[model samples]
Target: MATLSPEMPKSDDRKSSKDVVAKLNYVGEMHDRAVYDIRNPAGSNIVWDTRDVTIHDVRPHLDKFTMDTQGFAFVKLPSKFAENPELFEGNRKARHFVTDDSLDVQYAQEICDYIQNMTGARDVFPRLGGLVMRTSTRASAEKAAWAPPAEFVHLDFAPQAMQGWIDKTLAAKPRDLKPYSRVQLFQAWRCISPGPQDNTLAICDGDTVSSDDKVIVDSMTGDPSIPGNRWDSRMCHYSPDHRWYYMPDMEPDDLVLFKGYDSDVPDAMNAMHSAFQNPLGQTGVPRKSIEARILAFYD
Candidate 1:
């Protein structure tokens, strides 16, 4: 990691020692006793209702970890999608699919191209990534396409799940893909809401995370029509070496690019992240964001 001090220093507004409660998944031994249940499967809200869990007051030691050294980076994009905030509204589902002709879809494709350029990948394939809104208010929250801030520190894909997704996605496409030795998965996330967030994301530096720190868990999407099974994801335990950081007061224009999975790099494939409560956050405003997952192919 390069020297984080010369770049920027902690301020009174963004304190260094500040700690917030972060709910994380249980360690391996406790998993045997943990409960696994789908709460609102019909409503697309499925999670582990495990009683055995760890809720820790974690302090984001940002001075140590950063994007260049870690598996995450920040991008400044004064996007066209931010202009019309009402584009995503009044949807019961968690995500609304973007059409090919829609302006939102066009903006999303721009992000895909940005990732491809950054990674120097031959081709980038985009999934149906859409709007995700979160609010503290009951009425507005109920009507909107909402997802609670992910409490657990986890990666979106495990080995098997990623391979399955690749196989399934490629099989559906009409043309045969060119031979590629490496595949990388990335997520481009941006907060489309107006102000500062109370529940913000915290990312762990990939270099510090060890192999034994991760535990794979099944992500049940609640769609029973599909043949065999749910997606596989990873959950993590607290490690002394784990270095965490967060971008304070993120706005509509700011974008965060992070790694979900990378086949070429084994030691630091998935960048572990979760939304943590900000102790110094403003009142009333909730977090509303959009995230797109893209697959990058390298020959």
Candidate 2:
């Protein structure tokens, strides 16, 4: 059962004066637990029923949220690809289908370097296998091998799942490697398509999220018979106190970094995010974006 924070302000009190309204899907009440089986060829079987609740934008109060405080921060750091698209041919080829070999290694390294510089971590590892490209346009979604925008409000990984990844990663390194005092998982997201996105990504403030608001679900892919085909993810139960925000007219140069998990900080804010319909309607091209998962180690 998700509990609302008594100290938090009511939803109505924090409503944006701009009248931006959209529906966000959240885990609905269920007697049995939920599971996401992507192995189903016909279509993914999402046993976790969801309810779409009307939510208002919090852009007017953007100043209230910060990377350290709310676990997400938006920036306008332009990518090299954005400046010189012709220089990275692999990035262009990725529009069709993204694979470890298809994505440019240089591009991935650049992002890793950017994250390292921004967070000042001793080391940063990019999960190349976790790189994903998503689109919202119907034509593009069908033609491209990429996935559509995710509509559910949820966190990417549960604590145990993240810990398992960390353990596995550390185990693969040399025995003589120095031990890190802290580790953080983050997702760096950016728009790849045109501006004025019709379906934008919205993030929930971590401070407003109660620990009880999360439900763990089995996130499965590929063959169910395979041992490594499953991992745990978190789904959120709707709460009135959850504050959501989104950048209105994001460009390809814009980037947002949000925390997924942090070691040595049990109560650290973990940004929960989802894609929602832009209530203002489609002003430009349908949203197409890329996201990269990164792990930062601090000694």
Model 2: lDDT of residue 88? 29
Candidate closest to the true structure, highest lDDT: 2
lDDT of 1 by residue, 1-299 (tens): 23323323333334454444444433444434222223344543224322222222222443344544577765566677654646555222544555657656666677777777666778887653354554433333324445556656778777776777777555544346688898878787776655556667777778878878776666654453562236777776667676666666676766777888877764363488876556556463666666767888888
Poorly placed runs, candidate 2 (over 4 Å): 1-19, 39-60, 82-103, 137-142, 167-177, 225-228, 266-269
Give the C-alpha miss distance for residue 101 in model 2, angstroms. Answer: 8.7
How far residue 111's Cα lies from its native spot in candidate 1, in Å, is 0.8
Worst 10 residues of 2 by lDDT: 1-10
lDDT of 2 by residue, 183-279 (tens): 8887878877666677778888888888788877777665646533567888888888887777666667667778888775554436989887786
**Model 2 alpha-carbon miss at residue 142, Å:** 7.2
TM-score of 2: 0.78
lDDT of 2 at 283: 59
